[model samples]
Target: PLQLSQHRVREKEAVKQSGVKTAKVKGVKNLEEIKKAIDEIGYPSILKTCSGGYDGKGQWKLLEEKDVKSINWNENVEYILEEMIRFDKEVSCLVVRGINRDIVSYPIGENSHKKGILNKTIVPARVSKDILEKVEKTSQEIRKRLD
Candidate 1:
């Protein structure tokens, strides 16, 4: 379950291995390093712990340089900075596979986030057929490779 356990790593590595373009990211060990990385990544970047974080528990949104100074750092933890993505919409694709390798995918679900926490999910997300297909295909590819 390495892929699933590494919540943040899977996102980056899946997009990379699948040849899908994703946000740029960097890992940092301290506040100073993060500030420097942000300068290169620009404002509106995301700062997240590399592991053991989920549901907005260990994430910070940096909309500006001043936001960096406000961070309360823990010397023992690692953090990652990611460029904020400007998306037309947010969606999640879920796939279920049995022990026999039979797989089924659910309709893409549109997602809403409030302060980086998933606020709502709507099935059969309102989108063009093409977008839905792309989402499912990508999800399936990831599942296959991980499996």
Candidate 2:
């Protein structure tokens, strides 16, 4: 279900949402285009395989343009160049929305994954009150979007 065009378009949204001034490869196809794409995106863009790959899987972070060829990418498979989403920690939120349209929000919980599989959840997140409110509000917004 990964549409090539859609992924490229979404990358822009991701870049803007991140609010980080980073470059991205715009629609790369072959080696020649990849090289050009990398030039546009600049170095340190994550070369992400945009299929069903997930949870840090099928992703490669290329720091330099020269190393782009070393990655064994299928000529047909398009790659999405994404800016690295860095943070002090990564967390997940679970919000329950009942069939009756009732919403119950859980506290944002820290998460740990092994080989891309979620392993455990740590509640009572040890983040600042401000950060907690920001994350919590974001989680609620995400749930609303999904609803």
Candidate 3:
């Protein structure tokens, strides 16, 4: 659980194992690796610390070649270069598992972010029923995998 919560790369790997689609990602240990990952992932990508970052901190958006030069790269810290995906809306599902291993999922929620911070979340996200069901199933799958 700590591994999943603290490491973005590990978390994304878990998500992928659960059959959820995720942005293309590659882990890097230094600036040279980051440049190589950017070349592979292409422009409009995001660089994020592998661990210990919250809210909007420890992230940089490399929209173009010039944007890469603006980052204050730290060679010691591990990072992940992820393909930036543009989406219509952001939604989430909360799933909880009891001590006895019983699992339950709440209704899907629509999330709105402001300046990289979560501003609001509306319950019963304004999405189709099929999409909501899929999200819930995916959430449960992720929770199960975490166990």
State which candidate has the highest lDDT.
3
Residue 62 in model 2: lDDT: 77
lDDT of each: 0.82, 0.65, 0.86
By TM-score, is 1 or 3 better? 3
**Clash-forming residue pairs, model 1:** none
Provide TM-scores for the models. 0.87, 0.66, 0.92
lDDT of 1 by residue, 1-147 (tens): 465447675567666676666788877889778978887898889899888888788988899878888889998987889999999889998788879978888889999888778999988898999999889888877777666
Q: How would the candidate models be sorted by lDDT, starting from the highest?
A: 3, 1, 2
Query: Over 4 Å off in model 3, which ranges?
Result: none
Error of 2 at 46 (Å): 1.3
Worst lDDT run of 10 residues, candidate 1, spans: 1-10
Q: Is candidate 1 or candidate 2 better by TM-score?
A: 1
Clashing pairs in model 3? none
Clashes of each: 0, 0, 0
Candidate 3 versus the native: TM-score? 0.92
lDDT, candidate 2, at 90: 68
* RMSD after Cα superposition, model 3: 1.4
